[model samples]
Target: MKMMAMALRRITLSPWQTALTALTIPSTTTTTTTTRPHSTLMSPPVVSLDLPDVWPPNSSHFHFPPPINYSNGHRAAVIDGKLIAEEIRSRIGSEVRRMKESIGKVPGLSVVVVGQRRDSEIYVRNKIKACEQVGIMSTITQLPDDCTEEHVIDAVSSFNVDPSIHGILVQLPLPQHLDEGKILDAVSLEKDVDGFHPLNMGNLAMRGREPLFIPCTPKGCIELLIRSGVEIMGKKAVVIGRSNIVGLPTSLLLQRHHATVSVIHAFTKNPEHLTREADIVITAAGVPNLVRGNWLKPGAVVIDVGTNPVEDPSCEHGYHIVGDVYYEEAVRVVSAITPVPGGVGPMTVAMLLLNTLDSAKRAYEFS
Candidate 1:
């Protein structure tokens, strides 16, 4: 099996180097350069944000200028995932219509839910709704938690052979009684638009090969960066976590785009220091607000894939969804950032639609 290129060099910092990189950006600009006191290891780095117009005056700002928008008001540009996802879906809808008119076939997506988990149900419902809005046929098959592995596989097998179904997804977090891997392995790869099949993963990891589908969330993260005009080629990028679904695949995709990549997981020491060296950061670690402003390189672009719920007394639900990066702090520091609830969630669904549409076109050889 091909491996993702290990190109991200580990960084060691001196006292001055640490001070220069970790300093907090000032809310305003200044005419003269200034130096800042070094912060202790226990505290975040503090540097003078006020740099003189003259070059090499006070401190080095990550070898790059502070974000253009940050100087205006310490306000980072908000990447609106909702609008981008909506436009993608609209374009998919138009393509679906064209395919249907010319080839007499529309895309179809089938979601197989194994149990009554509320979260799984909600996800399936949203997916089905998205398919509907895009004019793709949606099918849902809900089995009981006690259902045997064979039973679930049987459902998948039926969808695999059915002429009407073009894409098949087995809702994740299968009950404890079932073998998730065996069942997932049974799904025909051609219909595996989720891109979870081992072959697809292998293709994604190989330099010259291509996966039939890129996993939705990671694809969405890259889409947001590309659409927002963040350069990826020859840039430094860090992806937090190493899960097969998000982190591992995301790192591979970044490498495919020619960005030098690093993946920091629970085992990584001083993750903040490594992250601060990156020009582009895509964080999928589930821990809520795990990334702070001080962890970022000034003018870095952040794409947060975490959606953790934290208690909130002010909201009606008493819970709010937040990404791994601290929004309040990161926005002021990074050049561009994505919001938790709206950032990657919508794009995942949009990519699913595109994948299903692609499946239909492949089936009919219309594309």
Candidate 2:
């Protein structure tokens, strides 16, 4: 939990403190330094982007709880993951430099990407770029969409045995023909930086046990809550979706922090009813605009993990990224919410770096 230790240090910020500083500062304000133990994870001094412009029109069924007045007239404070990630990367760069100076070693990450899915490739590219920014050596093993399961497993296995590679990640959503579970299980537990190994999941699920590495996306979600000064202990949380990569682990992590968590999936009845009771909501269903305004409880803190792309012929890319929760409606109801592109997405990369660094620390016996 060393990486989590950094996040735990900042969970003490009070609601009033968050209200006062959350989104009050303008986007142009200079970033400020802090003495907090995990200050690097804190929301930056200024809002990275204005919410009203990025978010859509909103309405909420529950209004008993007064909204925190962000300076920009948005009811909810934006959890700017981009700025937070920059801080984390800056800190990691410093640590990597320190490690190299002290032990003549740096972390290395190997990614095994299968298939030509545009989203998967883009994500892998971002991961490689992030690794470079933090001084981690990264290598990518790309395979064709038609590659056999054994080919993907061999790719992961090679990295596992490579002493220089401290972390190994298998880019998700493998080809339909491949057995994903078998391939993931093939990764050595020690180098499973993506934390997909069954052992890691088991450790995460059990009490009095901790995984060698936590899954990055779930770890990032908690970091967002911590960095945003949202208290998790004793709060009601609802997680939509139950994928191993994000949802199930997120719900487990929330429970670790003493939150009462409910999970909603495709089979669930009255998903909105379960969601509205949560103080914190994390949606990763991958269905765009699945969680509407009425699904949220007033004053709830939301982390939108969904990154579905919607085609928009007008946009340059012809597609725009969006979260599972409807930004427009949820913004008005929730006291705090993370935007799709600028929220949990960046934190995921940051946490991956942290995990790789941690694995290197273990391998090198660096404090």
Candidate 3:
């Protein structure tokens, strides 16, 4: 029982724990908070502040640079996710430097990769690169494709107790021979930067509870929407796909922002019909061109999370990536849209850095 109490206290110190609390509790000035009864989906507590009603109520903290070099030829404003991601990374880098200077400590991330899948290798490589750019120390434990589940668990356990390591990530899609759930459960809750732990997901689903870390991809989707100045509260949002990684958590996040959300999956009939009525659409169906122009409501904001590889001999690589929504058609219809390659991809990595930095701050009790 003593061990469990200690663990619970550690989880409560996550930086995200205060994101809603800051707004929910009124201040001395003209700010007032009005919270309704919690719904089944656990909508966030709504607060009315004296400041402007923007996507991110606390934009002053980020000091985001003005959007630049965006494509304007289309009817819809192209959301430059890559540029926003760069800006976020810059802020994270600065914060990392400050932490090191004040406390003589930097964030550290550990990744355990089991297989030799080409896509997984690229993902791991990009994560390591992002850590390097943000001044975070990263270590990798590469196991053979046929390694036993115990081997993977042992590696993760080693990092969990390491004071120097603030984040522990186990690369997904483990070998068929391994038990994925057991391996994931082996990661300590305090260091589960991937946010796949059951406890973290449970907190995310509850009304007043906050997760230590939001899953990187889902968190990235929300960041893209907020930076683009899309108003989420009281809007009709539709999520395509219901996978644990990007789809399910994303819908939950949208609800947290007070958006009325609908989810479309393989079993859902006439998915496009439901999508066409949404003010905002986030599709991660992984089926390229699944969402066409006709599927969207005019003036709707679209975030394409799908990155399906299609053969393109004309391109430098053997294949090129396409999104669930057909861009050429979407650009002309929606008021705003994120392109496939430059959209959610970079934001995912940036969010990981943010989570790692937050973890380290909690570990060292840094402000």
Strongest candidate by TM-score: 2
Candidate 3 deviant stretches above 4 angstroms: 1-74, 313-317
How would you encode candidate 1's per-residue C-alpha lDDT over 140-227 as one tens digit per residue? 9989889999899999999999988999999877898888778889988889888888898899999999899888878888999999
Tell me the TM-score of each prediction against the true structure. 0.77, 0.80, 0.78
Model 1 lowest lDDT segment of ten: 50-59
Off by over 4 Å in 1: 1-72, 116-119, 311-318
List where candidate 2 sits over 4 angstroms from the true fold: 1-74
Clashes of each: 1, 0, 0
Lowest-sum lDDT 10-residue window in model 3: 50-59
The C-alpha lDDT values of all candidates are 0.82, 0.84, 0.84
TM-score order of candidates, best first? Answer: 2, 3, 1
Provide the lDDT at 323 for model 2.
85
Show the colliding residue pairs in model 3: none
lDDT of 2 by residue, 161-221 (tens): 8999999998997877998899999998988898989999999999999999999999999
